[model samples]
Target: MTIYLLRRLFLLGTVLLGLSIFAFSLGYLFPGDPLQNFSGLRYLDDSTREQLTLAYRLDGSYLQQYLAFIQRLWHGDWGLSLASQQPLLTEIRQVLPATLELTSYALLVSFFVGIPLGILAAIKPDGVIGKAISAIAITGYSLPIFWWGLLLIMVFAVGLGWFPSGGRLGVLYEIPPQTGFMLVDILLSDVSYRQAALQDALRHLLLPTLALATFPTTVMIRFVRDAMLDVWEQSYIKTAKAKGLSRLQVLYRHGLRNALLPVIRQIGLQFSTLITLAMLTEVIFSWPGIGRWLIDSIYQRNFPAIQAGLMIISVLVITVNMLTEILHTFFNPLARKR
Candidate 1:
């Protein structure tokens, strides 16, 4: 097991190294003046241009600039934002937790709801519940995220107004940011209307979480349903049934564990999609997260922020996949035996 983990860790390092190269090259791959918007003018005086160039290391050759970037990165110095002039890491620290919080709630919604629906659907493939589950999965899989988000906004945000249209908190609660996560920050806050603040935060999260969860929940259902079917027909499942185990025991105890391997793998595979959806969802809902922050950075032509967001997002996805692989391998004894 130790050897297996060590090997996977080595592979993870190699993957991250390759990803870093790809991510770093993105700065040069796109056609843009990283310093063009520095002064927000079509043309600049030579002195201003020179200062901008030197400030951004444009005076160096591409190789030299790349080397400098690598050196800075090695020393944990993520570059300053071209737009705000703040450190990129500092901006990420402010925004990433919001994204993480949003994604966490969405995953919770998907996991809690989808797994049971999937297990039931798999157990009763020909029944009414199974058919309904299938329909939901199909509907969710077919909907475009942008359209879905808009539809949600129209229904929940505009028509009913049960949830707030956007933003992390109601302006009424002036809770100072303790953690970047609003939900956590709310709990830590000692405001007089603390309960109201907590409720408001949750209300704000509802629409966006539902919108972001739609696709992944459907995917999870399908994965679970399919995996359960495959596991149901396994010899051990039949043996457990033959032993007169209750239906629930035979299924949950003997079948669900083996069935979960693929579902666990899908959880990792789905993370990138979650990030992508979160971007669109953030835009639609005006939620403060790295996704929306990246969008704004792109609009402002903040090259450092853009590059940093990409690198951080790519590394996050890669790391999640690596961890998922480790969990998948660790859980499957047959794989460990090999």
Candidate 2:
């Protein structure tokens, strides 16, 4: 297992390195000068723009800039954003946790809710419950996340006034930031602040989480149902039944375990995809996260921030995939042998 982990780590490193290069090259290839976006400001002039370009090493040849960027990366300098003129890492640190929180909650919802519905659907494939589950799954799969988020806002926030419309917390609450996670930050703060912040965060989280989770939940439901059906038809399941195992025991112990392998893999892939979706959701909701920051940087042509965000996201996705591969191998010994 140690050897396997090391191999996976190496592969992950290679994938990240390749992705960083690609992302950097793509950013470099984007049209329009970063300085031009700031050109209209009276304080900025040609000399200042030249200095800024030189400082960022953008004035150099493409090969030279790429080499310098790589060198900076190796030394743990991710460069400064043209927009904020702050270190890219600093900006990312502020936003990454919010995005993670959103994605993590969404994943939890998908697994706990979707998987159970799937199991129930599979258990009574021809029943009313199964058809209802199938209909909901299809609708969820078809709904665009932005549209879902807006619809949720209209119903829950605008219409019913059950939740705040947007932002991480209510304006009345003041919670000190410890972790970037609003829920955790609130809990760690004063009691008076905690209650309102927690409530506000959860209310704000609901729509975004549901929006982020919709497609993945639907996909998981279908996959889990199919996998369970396949596993139920296997000889081991039949043996368990012939041995007079209770139906629940045969389903849960014998069937579900075997069925989960595919679901596990899908969950892993969805988790990675959630990061990207979280960005879009964050933008739509005006929530602060890496995605929001990335979009801002893109508009400002902040190369360093864009590169750093993309590199970090790419590394994270690769790591998640590697971990999933490891988990799959562990769960099915035959996978490792192959």
Best by TM-score: 1
Q: Please, what is the TM-score per model?
A: 0.89, 0.88
Taking the tens digit of each residue's C-alpha lDDT, what string does model 1 give over 1-338?
99999998899889877777775677666556544422223456889788767755777887766666676677767867777767778889999999999998888888998899899899998899999999989999999999998998888889998888899899988889988888888888888999999999989999899999999999989889998999999898889888999999888787887887767777788887898899999999998899999999999877667778888898899899888888887888887888
Candidate 2: stretches off by over 4 Å: 1-7, 32-67
> Could you tell me which 10 consecutive residues in candidate 2 have the lowest summed lDDT?
34-43
The worst-scoring run of ten residues by lDDT in candidate 1 lies at: 34-43
> Model 1, residue 283: displacement in angstroms?
0.3
How much is the lDDT of residue 136 in candidate 2? 93
Clash totals, every prediction: 0, 0
Please, what are the lDDT tens digits per residue for candidate 2 over residues 1-338?
A: 77887888888778877786786576536555544322212245778877756755787787766676677677767756677666667778898999999899999999998899999999988999999999999989998888888888899889998876678877787778899888988888877657766877888788788788888899889988998889888998899999999999998788977888766677569988798788889988788989998898888766666667888888788778788888888788767777
Count of backbone collisions in candidate 2: 0
Q: How many pairs of residues in model 1 come into backbone collision? A: 0
- Show the colliding residue pairs in model 2: none
